[model samples]
Target: MDIEKYIRNIADFPKQGIQFKDITPLLANKDASAQCLENLLQLVGGQKIDKVVGIESRGFFFGTLLAQKLNAGFIPIRKPGKLPYTTLKESYQLEYGMDALEIHEDAIKKGDRVLLHDDVLATGGTASAACSLIEKLGGEIVQCNFLIELKGLNGIQKLKKHIVNSLLQY
Candidate 1:
């Protein structure tokens, strides 16, 4: 399924000179979404994933599905103060400034294998911060997965230490 056709490009979304790849079209179509999930699972292969760490709102969409399909726990990495329990935080630099992400302190156990998921890989700041939080909780990052990747941004650079996979690249 040419997933790219299901993705809509919006100009200057959330900022100027930025083209946002919107996945709503893909998400709305059952066939496309299923194909994407299947592809993601293929990328994961048969590796053991103890937990699937999803970054923020968009990540939740496919992250939870991946967790269910893998029979792994679903952990949410959100903005500061978004989590109710004791949380750990990690901050990273964005193109314009900085932002922080937090996860529950007990979200992962020592030696747990984790798969990180997100909607897009732009600057790598958010995903990198999530990785830090997971490592701080003693969760070993198994792989970083994304629905779309802007290769021009070189977001994968910050995630060089771990395996990174994505369904689409632009």
Candidate 2:
């Protein structure tokens, strides 16, 4: 549906030389938002997703909705200490700095099939870290899905072992 048109491009955002893709426009439009969700749902039509693990913040929106659409449980991977229960954490390096992410220790049960959902795929650090956390909790990553993918960043290259689907690429 060419969802890119619905995303506003803000130049030099958050810092100089950075172009931010904002989804606020899409969020405000009912048809566009519904179409985006429909497209994402179609991508995993038959996969048995036992749960949908969303990366923190932005991912929460799409993850929770997708989980409901798929009738799967929603699991969230958050910043350290953000989760109220015992957690499993993974730290990784990024171009700017190093950060960590955590998932509840018991978020995933043994042999659970998970479909990880996030708003964007950039550099793949966060997604990769989340994938590790899911595996640590004994979940099989059935697939990873996103609304947008920054292709220039080559984020998918870092996530080599699982299937990845993105509705729009930039």
Candidate 3:
């Protein structure tokens, strides 16, 4: 399936000099969404996943879908106090300052095989922070999955320790 064709590119969106690759167009089409999900699942390569840790909002979309398809528990890693529980947080450095993400302390058990997910891999700060939160809870990261990866940004450098895969790269 040509999933890239379904992606909507918006120039200078959400800020200046940023080209956003929107997935809503792909999400809107049933077959395209299903195909993309299948492609993402293929990235797992049949490995057993105990939990799927999805980042914030966009990650929640296919994150839950991947969990359901894998028959694993879905764990949401949110920003700040979005989760109503005893949470563990990990902060990361941004271009100007710092940002953080939180996960429920009990979200993952020791030795659990986890698949961390996000909609896009930008500067790698967000994903790296999410990885820290997973590690703090003792979950072994099986793979870091993303729908789109912007290679020009060099996000993969920060995630050098893990297996990274994406359906589409820009």
Q: Please write out the lDDT profile of model 3 over residues 1-170, one tens digit for every residue.
A: 79889999998786777888888999999999999899999999999999999998889999999999999999999989899999998888753358899999999999999999999998899999999999999999999999999998899999999999998888
lDDT for each candidate structure: 0.94, 0.89, 0.92
lDDT of 2 by residue, 1-170 (tens): 66778999898776677777898898888888889999999989888889999998888987899999989999999999999999898997654468999998989999999999988888899999999999988999999999899999899998999999999899
Candidate 3, residue 13: lDDT: 82
Candidate 2 RMSD computed on C-alpha atoms after optimal superposition onto the true structure: 1.2
Compared with the true structure, model 1 gives a TM-score of 0.97
Candidate 1: what lDDT?
Answer: 0.94
TM-score of each: 0.97, 0.95, 0.96
lDDT of 1 at 44: 100
Off by over 4 Å in 3: 94-97
Q: By lDDT, highest first, what's the ranking?
A: 1, 3, 2
Q: Cα lDDT for residue 4, model 2?
A: 74
